[model samples]
Target: MALFGFIGAGNMGLPLMKAAAATFGKNEVIFTDASKERSQFVSDQTGIRFLTDNCSVVKQCKNLVLAVKPQFFPVVLNEIKDVVTKDQIVISIAAGIKIESIKSMLSNSVRIVRAMPNTPAMVLQGMSGICFSEDTFTDEEKEIIDRFFKSFGKYEVFDERLMNAVVCANGSSPAYVYMFIEALADSVVSYGIPRDKAYELAAQTVLGSAALVLETGEHPGKLKDQVCSPGGTTIAAVKALEEYGFRNAIMKATDACYKKCEELSNK
Candidate 1:
């Protein structure tokens, strides 16, 4: 079994640990966190070994997952920089932290895989964007990482330059989708639908629509056209949305998210 270690045990890290432990079993995992309580709690909950320090986890596991927030990344890197070695494969989920930045912070000899996984991973329905330098990973190593990511949700390997857009489209889109759901539910509630049932209906509709897009591989507009008859309810609602600037609103929101990602990287 391959040993895996997580350096942060918060929301994002905890889910990954849970999913990983379910696949590889708890014995193959180890972790450390800034919060000793959270570290102990997650270890107890998942039956993984918990260490008191970052270096301790680095020493025990060859596959290291850097799950700390971007703001704390440098500090964490400094803590384990001396202990990280060439054989250790470091997978970083810290958004906007470039692979080159991590390489410079640590030793250039260490293998690194940069990944952007969205909030959906918390619910095990994540879409992750993975990119690594061509020479940094062997076929077996790549397979292992791919398997681990798929165990949680979907994974796509893309050119590193597009990672930021992936952040906008997948990583940050969840919040926008949630907002859309909330607005839809609210509108129905105004029409006398029970608030709770309205939420369920709205959310499930979005879920089903997304599934249709994926399973059928049809253009979304074509799918929408199917729902809307020559002179029907769906088109009327869609027209209203267009009048309300729905497309423009979504584009602006994603653009803002993309800009924020760049800002984070600069910081």
Candidate 2:
């Protein structure tokens, strides 16, 4: 049996298929995209077979990924609705589309997995959240989905209700983190450091700090304390950030993103 098939071969889908094929052999993967050139390009790079159409992908692969955007979902869903089977696992990456809605659109007995994966998955450092319905997935199926997600990076299983929250924390926050990196590098560059060197320093510091959090299992506050020597430069900068409402601004930004996720999910 083929390991997996992907219906969308855009940026995120291509990376996911690459990661999956890397973890689970390329010959077991099959896929197609709306754009035939891109579909063939991904298949060529990964050594996975490229099907002529989405229905062929569904008929041929046991595990199928629905990676099309929200706007394109209806058309794509209609195209393969006939071919998707009860025994097959259908995973949807579309933001805000609920599992129940998808199930209603297709066969009731189909196994469904809903997931929200961040942009970092492209670099094999993603944080993904998955939710499964009782009627749709067993514990074994959930484990399979979790393993598939972790092939790219970290993954956490959560209740379906929390999927939107995951979108805010991991999916939307990457852009915010990039903005922080750019701002930090700009500030350092203004102080005479070359822009490239400043960016390298800022990016590496953020990377290392995140790794520290994961490795040490320590609260970020304690880690911050460790970095701030008594009356040191780090303390001065921390004070400036506090004065500028940095923490409040970040909280508000995440809140805004969370609200947007809710709005999109309804759509």
TM-score for each predicted model, relative to the true structure: 0.96, 0.93
Compared with the true structure, what per-residue lDDT tens digits does model 2 show for residues 1-267? Answer: 677989998877988988889888887788898988887777777788888888988998888999888778878888888889888899898778888878777877877889988789999998988887667466776666777898999988889999888887887888989999999999988999999999999999999999999999999999999999998999999999999999999899988877877776676
The prediction achieving the highest lDDT against the true structure is 1
Off by over 4 Å in 1: none
Flag regions of model 2 displaced more than 4 Å: 136-143
Model 2 / residue 102 / CA error / Å: 0.9
State, as a TM-score between 0 and 1, how close model 2 is to the true structure. 0.93
Model 2 whole-model lDDT (C-alpha atoms): 0.86
- In order, the Cα lDDT scores of the candidates are 0.87, 0.86
Best candidate according to TM-score = 1
Worst 10 residues of 2 by lDDT: 133-142
Question: In candidate 1, what are the lDDT values of residues 195-255, reduced to their tens digit?
Answer: 9999999999999999999999999999988999978898899999999999999999888
